[model samples]
Structures are given as C-alpha cells and as structure tokens.
Target: MGLYHNRPHVQDIRRMKARGEKISMLFVTTPDEAAAAAAAGIHMLSIEGRFFDATMREAAGDCFVQVGLPYGGWGSFNGRPLATAEDYLRAAFHYAGIGGDAYYCAASYDIQKTLADNHIPVVGHIGLIPSYISWTGWRAVGKAADEALALWRHTQKLEEIGVFAAELEVVPDRIAAFLAQNSSLVMLGMGAGPHADAQYLFTEDVCGYGLNHKPRHGKVYRNLGPELARLQEARIEAFRAFKADVDGGTYPAPEHVVPVKDEEYEAFLKAAQG
Candidate 1:
C-alpha cells in the first residue's frame, strides 16, 4: 500500500468525474508503453492481468490503473476455466495485491457483485462487449429506442450492484452523455462520446501499430509500423555483416585477439623441445 501512496486512489478518480474533468485512459501492454504514458501524464491505464506486475505498476507511476481480469473461459486455473465468483475474486485479489487501483471485469453481474461486496473497486462493461458479440454483432449498440432503454437499465443495474465504473463502448453520443450525467458510475467511454468521464483507447490503436481494421472511433496519432519495419531491417543487416566477417576470417583478426609475449612463447617452445 505504501508503494502506491502517491498514485491516485479510487476516490481521486471519483472526484475527477464529479468535477466534470475529462480523463484520458489507455490500454497498455509493455513496460515501455506504461512508462511513456506516465511521462506523458495520461490519467488512467487499463492493463490485463497477464501483463500486470510490480514492474508494470512501477512504470505506470501515478496513473490510476485498472487491471482487467480474464472473463469466463478465457481464464484458467489448474486446467479448469474460471467460471465462478470465487475464481474471479481470487484473480481480483492477486492483481490488487500487485498494486492495481481498480479492476475491469466483464464477468456476470453476480461475480461483479462479489468483488464489489468485498470492497474492491470494479469497472464493468456495457455496449457491444466483444466476448458477447455473438448477440450484438460488431457494431454500435443501443441505437434503437428499446435497446437504448435496455442500456439505461443495464447501467442502473450496475450501479445497484456497486460497480463504480463501466466501459461504455460504441453507443450513441446522446445516450452516453445522458448516462454519464445520470448514473453514479464513472463512464470509461471507448466510442461512447465526448461527455463520458474518461476517453479510453488501446495504445496500439493510438500508436498506429494495430491491424488493418481500425475502429471508427480510434484515431492514429503516429504511424510507427513503418519505423518498426525499418528497425527490423537494420537488425538483419547488422547480423548479416557479423556472419560475413566470421566466414571471411575478418573476425578475430590480430587486433581482436590476445597477444602472447615473445619471451614467454620461446620459453614454452624450449621446454617442449627438452
């Protein structure tokens, strides 16, 4: 706890929402990216459990970090899928002990309640959950009037269950704006709109290293793909030069080898002859 004394706590994030301040959030996988986000003063970060550790937490610095627990069959324990509330609770505690400020759980409501009941700060998901996309398909949710009402009810249910925040993804702007204002839970908007408590995006999407199918909501700031390719080519060239030198006997040349004194060599030669 002392290690995280300087980092923003749950209450600090709540205060940001209360003050109507727009927060910036990113999903980062590497320590370098976390450190860079820390240096850039990003307000929040979402790190998956596999990538979250003491080193990653330290690199995140003062940013409020939400550790994502793998949902349903995606998480395993001793060859079994994590399908129960206790399974998720154990995972949540593990990350919490590692310095996670909050947890992102797209599990069932009952599981979410278990974490919330234990006083763990939890963030739930709404609108086009990728795991549950078989029902909604890969498109914006809550577009129709009935779907919008259902989304509102879903938000209310989350608040009732004690979830402190939700990842409001790919919903209409007006619906998201209304939900953010009316609901107690902080809205971590992906493509929800400008009015959500925090604007969230994946670091890969922001850095332009993502796959070809870019989400309409994502904005690429810098194209690092070409630069990364260039660096790879340079690495190959350097390795090729080393191989060529070794094959041509240019490596281990006189300057690269240790020299034996003439007197020492002569002494050894005379002793051998004797």
Candidate 2:
C-alpha cells in the first residue's frame, strides 16, 4: 500500500497537470480492462461507478482509477440531479474504501467543493460536457473566441474551488493549449488536442468495440473485438463437445467405471431366484 500503490498524491497530479504534461491513458469499465491498461504502462484510468469495487481495484494494480460517480446523463449535470454536496462526499468515501485514486464528477461547484473539503481529489469536466450540452450542443466546444474564453474562466474557477484536475473533452488543440498553459488544473484531453496535461479515451472506443466509428483522435493499439469473438466461439465448441460425449455415452469409459464382483452378483441373483 506504500511504495507499490499506483495512486500518486493529489498534489502530485496537480503539479503535473499544471505543467501541461502529456499523461497518456484511457478509461476502463471492467477488471480485465483495468488489468490490461495497467500492463500497458498507462498511468491513468477512469472507471465507471458500477466498476468501483475491490475486484476492479485489485485488477488495476498501481494505475490511477478515477471512480465516476453516477450523477445522470452518463457524465453530465442537469438541474439539481446530484442533490447536495453530501452526495459527492459520500460517493467519494465509499469508493475510496476500495483504493480509488481519484473522483470524477460533473456536479456544480458547491458539490465539487464538498468532495474536495473532505480531501477527495475531484476531477471536473470541461468542454463538450455532455450533461450540459444544452448550451453548447453535441459538438466540439471552445472553438470560437468567446467559447474558449469561457472555458478558460471555468478552468480557473475549478482551481479556485480546490479541484485537483479537470477533464477537457472534445475541443480543438489550439484552444486546449491556451487553456492548458493558463490554468492551474490538470487538463485531461478527450480529443481536446495535445495541449492537455493528460490524454484520455474510453477503453471501449480504443478496443474497436465502440458503437460509433472510432474518432479521429483515438488510436487503437489492440483489436480485441475479433479476439473476443473468436474466444467465444471456442468456448461454445468446447461445451458442444462435452454435450456430444454425454449423449453418446462415451464419457464414462471402462477405465472410468467400477463393477460389482461376479461372486456377489451371482449370490444376489441366486437368492432372489430361490
């Protein structure tokens, strides 16, 4: 839990984000995905609230796991959906029990501060925030001067409230660079360009199993789709073989069966006949 622990200090992540370093990684939704990401030397990860348990933590090894608390709209904030700051605090402590390195939320500033006050490293969302897409629509945000400027201000506000890092999603490189250079928060880029402190992508999108075509920014290192399909086929075949053996009475061979002694059988039959 000491030296080998994959989680870095909150201040450590802050320093790196402030420096505009390229923290390479993707989000994982399963133990197997986390294990694979850890094995690949990816330093950071985002795990959904559903996956926030001891099993996933053990599988993640030393990699950073940012537990995504379910707020609503997947990763968005609409209305008073999250309710109060206690919601964030409770979820933070709950997941932290299993060694979650950080917390990701799209809640309001008050809610974010509640988590931070309790010593939780909160990762806020910026640019193309899906939950608040009503204002910006479902497209790249911060492209225009005013939009970029607003995002810059948003970054500043997050830092002011004591957040450790922010996810800068789906903005252009130039705007992302400017925000990265100015803000104190760690900029986790999801197609928001190389200006971010870390590059973030979803494990599903990277594995070629995404519902939509792979985005231009996502670079697939492995194609597990076909591999997984092939494995499923093999499993089905193995089960079929066992079923066939059972139906044909070929499973319990002579060496596998025991027989009653001839003397015992003869005595039983003779007694019954008499």
Candidate 3:
C-alpha cells in the first residue's frame, strides 16, 4: 500500500465544514476514474467496498476515500451474507487496512456504532436512502414539516452514533441548507444545494455515460456517451475487418509471415518425403 498519510482525515473534513469551504466529492468505481478525480484535486471519493483495495487507494492518491460497506444481504463473506454488526465491522476494518480514510455504512445503528467505536470514520446516509426507497419511493425528502423534522432527528441520531458525515441526498434545498448550518455532521450533498459542506456526484453522471435514468440534480458536464458508443462501433468494425481479411486470405501476406531459408525448407521437404 502506498503511504496515504496526506489524505484528509475526519478532523480535516470537519475543519473544512467549520471554515465554510465547499468540498468536491465523487462516487467512482474504476481506478481511472479515481486517478482522474485525484488529478482534479477532488476532496473526497466514495467507492464501494467491492471496488476498493490497495490499488484503488493508490489511484485515489491523497483524496479522502469513503469505502462503502454493502448493506445487509448485499454484503457477504465467502458466500455468506453479512447479517450482523460484526460482519459489517469486519468489512469496514478490511477496507480501512487497505488505506480507506472513511466508511459509508447505511446499515443499522449497531453496525454504524461498531465501526465508529473501532475508530473507523463512518459516513451515514439520510434523506432518500435508495436501499429503503420502498418506504419513501423515488422523490425528494424533507418536503413536509414532519418529514423534515424526522430527517433532522435522523441526522442527530447518526451524530450520536459517532458518524462524522452523512449523505444528504434529494432533500429540499431550503431544508438541507438549514440542517447543514445547524448540524455537526458534515453534509455530503447529492441534490441538497449549495449550502452543503461537500457536493457529491457519480462519475458516470458527470461524464454523461450512465445507462440509468438521470436524476434532476445530476448535471452532465460532458456528454461522453455518444463518443463511447462510437468507440464501441469502431471496435466492432475493426474486428469484422480482421475476420474478413482472414477469410479472404489477405491476412497472411508475405510481410506478415516469417521467412525460412530456401535450403532449410528444401531439407525439411526431403525429410518429410523420406
């Protein structure tokens, strides 16, 4: 593992919040994406545990990386599902050892607390957790007064559980602004507007290559989807041309084949005939 002492720690992120600095964060899966984010001087990166390792950490450079622990049944070890706090803790510790700066755990309070107690910086999720979308459906949260209050209470609960930050996703901008100003937890905003401590976006969304429906808050900075499609077409055409060359005996041209000495070929022919 490369030395990652220069990466931002939990206190550093909190200090950024205190200073009212707007942090840039991205959810990236590939090493190339991580390296690009690092090169661009992104403050934080959210990577899934499955995609995080020493290589990923190295690619992330000095950016604070939040390795996401897969929640509940989605998380596993040796074909067994992670169903308990210890299971989640093991996952978090594994990534932490790999140089992960923080962990994003949307698991139960017990799991979150376990990671935090072990000195693992934990980032919790609030306002439109996709995993629990069955209850709230796909929409902006904290619109109603009671719902907003519940969201505020949820943030407090996460803070009490020792979580250092929370993903404030798809909450009303006004509500999110109010909560960010009042809350101790650093808010990593997805759809939560300018008042957040950090603005988070998926790499695919920013690059405009995502296959899924784009969220209203996700801004496409570059439309690389068409370019990527063109590349795929080029790949197919190149393969087809190679196949056609082979079928038409145009591939094994004189220059493409190794030349043997005439005397050696004659000797081989004589031996074969004998």
Alpha-carbon TM-score of each model against the true structure: 0.87, 0.81, 0.88
After superposition, which runs of candidate 1 have C-alpha atoms over 4 Å from their true positions?
A: 1-4, 75-80, 239-274
At residue 66, candidate 1 shows an lDDT of: 95
- Across residues 1-274, which tens digit of lDDT does each residue of candidate 3 receive? 5554788888999999999998999999999999999999999999988899888999999899998888766665546677788887788778878998888888888888988898889999999998898899999999999999999999989989899999999999999999899989999999998888899999999999999999999999999999999999999999999999999989979998899999999999999999
- What's the ranking of the predictions by TM-score, best on top? 3, 1, 2
| Candidate number with greatest lDDT | 1
CA lDDT, every prediction? 0.91, 0.81, 0.91
Ranking by lDDT: 1, 3, 2
Could you tell me which residue pairs clash in candidate 2? 6-62, 76-131
lDDT of 2 by residue, 134-189 (tens): 88888888878998888888998899998888888899899888887887788888
Mark the 10 consecutive residues where model 1 has the least summed lDDT. Answer: 72-81
lDDT of residue 259 for candidate 1: 92
Off-target runs (Cα >4 Å) in candidate 2 are 1-6, 18-20, 73-82, 236-274
**Residue 37's lDDT in candidate 3:** 98
